[model samples]
Target: MAMPVSDPGRTRVVVTGLGAVSPLGPDLVSTWEAVQSTRPCVEPIPEAWEAFWKPKSRFWAPLPKEWIQCPLLAPLEPKQLDPVSILALESARQACSGGAPAGRGGVFVGTGSGGGASRFENHLNHLFPQKEFLPGRRGGRFNPFCIAMGMPNSPAAMISIKLSIEGPCRTFSSSCASGTVAIGQAAQAIRSGEVEWAVAGGAEYLVDPDGTQFHGFDVASTLTRIPTREECNRPFDAGRSGFLFAAGGAAMLRLESERSARERGAAILATLDGVAENCDAYSPMAPAPTGERIQQCALEALADAGLLATDVDCINAHGTGTEANDRIEAAMLERVFGRGPKVTTTKALTGHLIGAGGALEAVFCVQGLLDQIVPGMPNLVDPIADLDFVLRTQASEHRNVLKLSFGFGGHNVALVFTKAGTP
Candidate 1:
């Protein structure tokens, strides 16, 4: 039977919990503190990295080797925790710390290049000239687990199984915009009363040798010869080059407004006032230079929140450190904020998390609302536009914020998160 439609006045959505497994840190607190300090997380690829790629890029940010030691992850074998799975599990575990409500709750996660490393490595092992291919080799049928682990939807499936969640489960993959779109879709579901709670976020692990070769061949990664990871990505700087590659995950709990959260006594992190998504349909790999769709998406989100451009206090920019993205994003902000509000790009610190960028940026925006502070952009010495780019230090106060993310295939998403009880 079809479910009943939600009464427009009946349900409201708000953020009740948050989590992250990022280059900056494993959890929200640690990640936020590291971001505030502008600590660079990028590093030289490990020795094993060569097995994955040739003519390699300069730097990438891989999770610390110690993350597998966390008590929450003790259930799984160390080899089982591939980068994508590790990020998904860690972020979901943190987000659901308070426990999702007893009834149906949804799970949505986005990922780009899901588990490509594991699949590629397994393939090469069998295909090499010296190696023999056999049906029963090692774990029979080449271990169906590889496809299961590498599947983009595996993260959401794993999260649902781990948490025993009995409601909707979905995995969205729209190139780089996958994560943000997941959150937006989850919010819509809750607001429309499809579910009581939703776990939403994105994860990625694309720094592997196979992953790098694919991305570098596509000419999407920064090719700088810089020795240090810190100098690899320079978003919005006049001397900006391109985005540094990185891997990470972020997730958040969305509940039906303050009333439901307070009724269940869940901690209210922030309010997700509005969200909007748009597609340019112009190009699959690049955004339109005029940024018309991006501007439209932002305006729609602000309108959904019942606010004007001047009402937003800060912006989490989708600054990918690429020339086309930064310039187009700057134009969009100028069109919407009339010079743009206080803006910062966490990508400067975390690098681009691809499908995970949107959800992580959403978490950052929520943090800006809850902590009343805005994190700064790193390596942005010269301004690219007339906008106020938060730099060097974090902002002292932020009440309302807009988080924007644009991805390949011209996917644009904007989310407006307001302080609790804001009019």
Candidate 2:
């Protein structure tokens, strides 16, 4: 259900801070520059991982190793926490660093699979060894804390604890749309007066050391097996094969009510105009062919923002390179915006982060607005549909943007944003 906006004058939600550990870079500035330049960060999968899984997808956008060494993460014991929690903690640290820590606010994070859960499962498999036990076997060798660490709520809880946020803390796990849904829910909470502010975003690190888990996508034939790293991940291109699975990262934004932001003199990066979420109810892993529900979601988000479709100046599309997704999303965009606004997807550079995709792309939208420059779709040599694709960096006076996210369960979400001063 859409969140109830009780009072239009209650408080407008605005983004004050942003933090990210992405394939493009370790920080926000570097990542934004990479996007604007259409830089390619994909490289051959690390040799360590190749030794085990021999995955079909040879290339992926892996984050820098040094990005995780943040001072805010110093308090936690590294081995005890999963990489998911660590990534979220580091990103939240960046988002909350300089001033805006709403003690009474909430923490909301979206993720598909908890790293700790997968970690626990991997170890459990070894510990149990085919679900058999020797006679007189005493207590298993598995780590006792696995249960607590593996819970989906671990990241949210750790963020709340690290930042001392006392308000409602929640996690959304709606597949790939999880992060966007978490951000939407946080904005709703602010509008509903549930809290004055929130730490909202998504995090995911699905690169398993053993490499056994990612083989599922390979077996399903949903991952690209291109020979060269430079030649893959061409979103919207005619030669596109499939999504390039990669090492996932985390991104977070400090979302606060306008009043709180102004009172604290926080630098407003962008205004979160509105967010809409719905489902296709058509298939578990495929989008509706007619693009009906996706179109409805776009309209609903624009309506919530009190604007018409024409007002959207740009669209940060959910343009995964996969054939079905690209075509369906193109159809949906054509139906919604009529090829009027410029469209681009940063996934060409970031790979498919799955859970963290929406959050990182939303960050790109805000950064683009601040700079008035839209990043182009990297490696897009051919068009699959009738749409205006930004193939190179372009400057614009545009103020409003629509960021769309769709997940495997047909979950759809649209977030409308505007420049800080836009009404």
Best by lDDT: 2
Least accurate 10 contiguous residues by lDDT in model 2: 132-141
lDDT at 366, model 1? 83
List the pairs of residues colliding in candidate 1. 52-209
User: Evaluated with TM-score, which candidate comes out highest?
Assistant: 2
Query: Candidate 2's residue-wise lDDT over 1-423, tens digit each?
Result: 233332467579999989888888888878888887878688777676555456778777778777666666665466567778878888888888787544479999999886744564547556674554534322344555666667788888889987888889999998888888999999999988888999999988776644554666666666776677787888888888888775778889899999998888889999998789999998988888988888888888887887788888999998888888898888778776777898988888788888889998998888889989888876888888778899887797789999999999899999998999876
Question: Each model's TM-score, in the order given?
Answer: 0.89, 0.91
- After aligning candidate 1 to the native by TM-score, how far in Å is the CA of 392 from where it should be? 2.4
Name model 2 segments beyond 4 Å from true. 1-10, 47-54, 101-103, 116-125, 128-141
Provide the overall lDDT of each model, using Cα atoms, as 2-decimal numbers: 0.74, 0.82
| Cα error, candidate 2, residue 349 (Å) | 1.1
After superposing candidate 1 on the true structure, give the runs of residues whose Cα lies further than 4 Å from its correct spot. 1-10, 47-56, 69-81, 129-141, 209-218, 221-229
